[model samples]
Structure formats: C-alpha cells, structure tokens
Target: MAVHHETAEELVEEVFLFGRALKLAVGNSDSSLLPPALTGVLGMLSIHGECRQTELASLLCLSQSALSRQLSDLVEWGYITRTPDPDDRRAALVRVSDSGFEILERIKESRVARLSTMLGEWSEEQALAALESVRHLKDTFTDQARHASADYTLIAR
Candidate 1:
C-alpha cells in the first residue's frame, strides 16, 4: 500500500512533466496549426460525429454564445461545417469537414513522428512498458469519467 502511494505520486509528477513537454512541442510547431480551443471543438465533433449546437456547447462546457464564436472560426478555417438540423430546421448540427480530417491526419502523423524521435534511444522493452502503462492509465481515467457522469446523472435526478 505504501509502495502504491509512492508510485502514484511519482506518476502524477511525471505526467505533469509530460504535459509541459507536449505543450512546448506543439507551440514550437507550425503557426498555422489549430489552437487548443479550436482543437477541442474539432475533437468533440470528430468523436461525436454530428451534434446540435446546444448539445455541443454543453459537452464543451462553453456557453452557446462562446461556442458560436468558436464555431464561426472553425467554419472560417474550413475545419468544420454546420448544417441545418433535419429534425429541427431552426438549429444547426456541426461536424468536421473533409479538409479538417486531412489536417487532423497530418497533425496526428506529426505528433507520432515526434514521439518516435523522442523515444529513439529507448530499448524495446522500455518503450513497450511505457506504452502499456500509458494505455492502462488512459483506460482508468476513461472509466472514472464514465462513472462520474453516471453519478452526476443520478444526483441530478
């Protein structure tokens, strides 16, 4: 139990360092790239497919007005498209555009290449262990998020 507590603390510290390194890498990359705000909007759209503006705003924790501004920027950047909701012509549903998907692919490739370069000196065993650890951590967080949402729903009711 003591060992687990110490390991968790160390893992948290390392995760903060990893986040700083990632932010630095992203900031040093192409200026034309999407900012984090825009990335979040696009990422949610990509994950949820198409969703109404109100629903998207709620998911993003942004007010409808704030989301409107971001959505306008996304549309202007050719990263996303808004279409009239078939169910209710008064509302619009948003989704990533084809060009946006291409850009996303490029961004993904760049990050993968960067990570590969950074890991170049690592032994195969070390790299595999790190990968497995990250995968487990991600799964744990995902499960917790789901559980929290379920709990919130129950509380709200």
Candidate 2:
C-alpha cells in the first residue's frame, strides 16, 4: 500500500525525536568512548572496507581535507591505516586495523548495555520485535541512501 503523506510526516517526526533521544542519552556517556563524529567515521570505514581515500571521502560525503583530520587520529590510535594505493601511485587506501575492529566491538557492547538498561522492563518478545523493526528500518534507509548518494550534497566534512 502507498504510504500516506500524514503518516510519512509522523514517521519523520518520530525519527527525529528518536535520534535526539539517542544522542542525548547514549552519545555523551563515558570519557573513554570515542566522540560520535569519529565513531561514525570509523563505522563507515568498517562498512566500506579498504577503499581509496578519495572514494572514502565521497562515500562519507566529506571533503578529503576534512576526512584527513579524522583519519589522522585513527592512524595515531592504531585504529586504522592509510597506505599508498598500489594500483594508483598518487592515491592512498584506507582500512580499519585489527584494533579498530576491537574498538568497534567495545563501542557496540557499551551502547547495548546502556540501551538494555533502558529497556529493562521490556519482555523478550517485545525486545525482539523492537530489534526486528529497527533492523528493517535501517536496511530500508541504507538501500535508499546508496541509491540517493550520487544526488546528495555534502553538508559537513
């Protein structure tokens, strides 16, 4: 069935509010946790695997210079590597290091622990339903984003 405009608007509002709540709740915890911006960049790199710096920049919707700052920290922390692209002498390839995967796992565990506390009262079935819904929504949006990536203008680096 076709989605109604009002329903779509309601969904958008809910998503915005949900995102805000997530940020306010879980995004600010733990001094050791990486900043949200870097975490997001790392997450993207994890998804894309080893890719050229320029290609990663394009995929991330960030200019090369902006991406460089984040990449620098990742490299320093041994979370990721930037090496010469063998196929392209002038280009660099980016890949998440083993430590990067470990950090990502830690981040996931911490976030899940916090969220689980928040959902402590939920029944197993209720939690599973919520998980299913979120996964479905995420997959749908991911597909949409890939299709629309070419048309999106970078708003931030």
Candidate 3:
C-alpha cells in the first residue's frame, strides 16, 4: 500500500488526465442511455465483457449496493443485461446489451466526425506530425511507467 497521501492524489490526477485524453480522442458526446457519469462503468464492461457484480464493484471502487443500483438503472434502460452467475447462483453477472454496443458505436462515429472537424484547419503534414508526436509521448509514458513503484502497478488499470 502507498504510505503517502500524495500517491493517492497523483493517481487521481493521472485518472483525470486519462479521462481528458479520452474526451479529446473520442469526442465527449454523452448518450442519454450512457451518461457521462456512467461512461467509465460501461466502458469497463465493454472492455472486460461480463463480470460478477461484486467484482465489477471492486473494479470501479464502488460499494456493492451502489453498483447494484446503477446496474438496475442500466438494465432498465436496456443498455445492459443482468443474469445469475452460473458458478454462483446468488451472485449476478452483468453484460452490455446489443443496444449498448450500438450506442458505443454511434459515440465512436461522433468522435471520428469531431476529430475530422477539429483537424480540418490543419494541413495534412501538420496533422500527421501531431499524431506522431502524440504516439511517441504515449510510448514514452508507457515505457517509463514500467519502472514505477510496484504498488503503482497494483492500482493502475
């Protein structure tokens, strides 16, 4: 565990940076079914697929009661489906629905459209150069982060 409160703050700062990067890269259009507040939850589900509610809550740093309420809302909206976990009958597994996938696709399309509009004023060479620079920055961060404190790896997703 990290002994310093500064570590917690730094971790949070990085998460915010990631969120900002995502907003810039994918256009921050919030679908009614998948509101901005719930983006991380749904995005995690989208990336990891079905998972038990307890595990999902742990991953999201949420309480089981809180996650259950949120999941209920998603299920009501048809954005996600909930089912009994096969291995644990008492537990539930949540998965994104087809409608959820469709909404995600639409959001991605909006991101592409927005990116095009933003880059329209830039010359092709300028845009390409910016892309390469961003890629290198990303690679540098990844490479340097490999030697971070072992606890960082535990908390990093």
Query: Top model by lDDT, which number?
Result: 2
lDDT of all predictions = 0.84, 0.86, 0.77
Off by over 4 Å in 3: 1-28, 31-33, 122-157
lDDT of 2 at 55: 81
> Candidate 1: how many backbone clashes?
0
Judging by TM-score against the true structure, name the best candidate. 2
TM-score of each: 0.82, 0.85, 0.63
lDDT of 1: 0.84
lDDT of 2 by residue, 91-149 (tens): 88889999999998888888878888989999999999988998998999989987676
Q: How high is the lDDT of residue 51 in model 3?
A: 92
lDDT of 1 by residue, 1-157 (tens): 3559888899889989987887777634533677777777887888888899898998888999999999999999899998999999999889999988877777767767877787889999999998898889889978998899999999999
Stronger candidate by lDDT (2 vs 3): 2
The true-versus-predicted C-alpha distance at residue 4 of model 2, in Å, is 1.7
**Candidate 3 vs. truth: CA RMSD?**
6.8
Candidate 3: give the clashing pairs: none
- lDDT of each residue in 57-121, candidate 3, tens digit only: 87777998887888887788888998888988988889999987887777667777878886789
Clashing pairs in 1: none
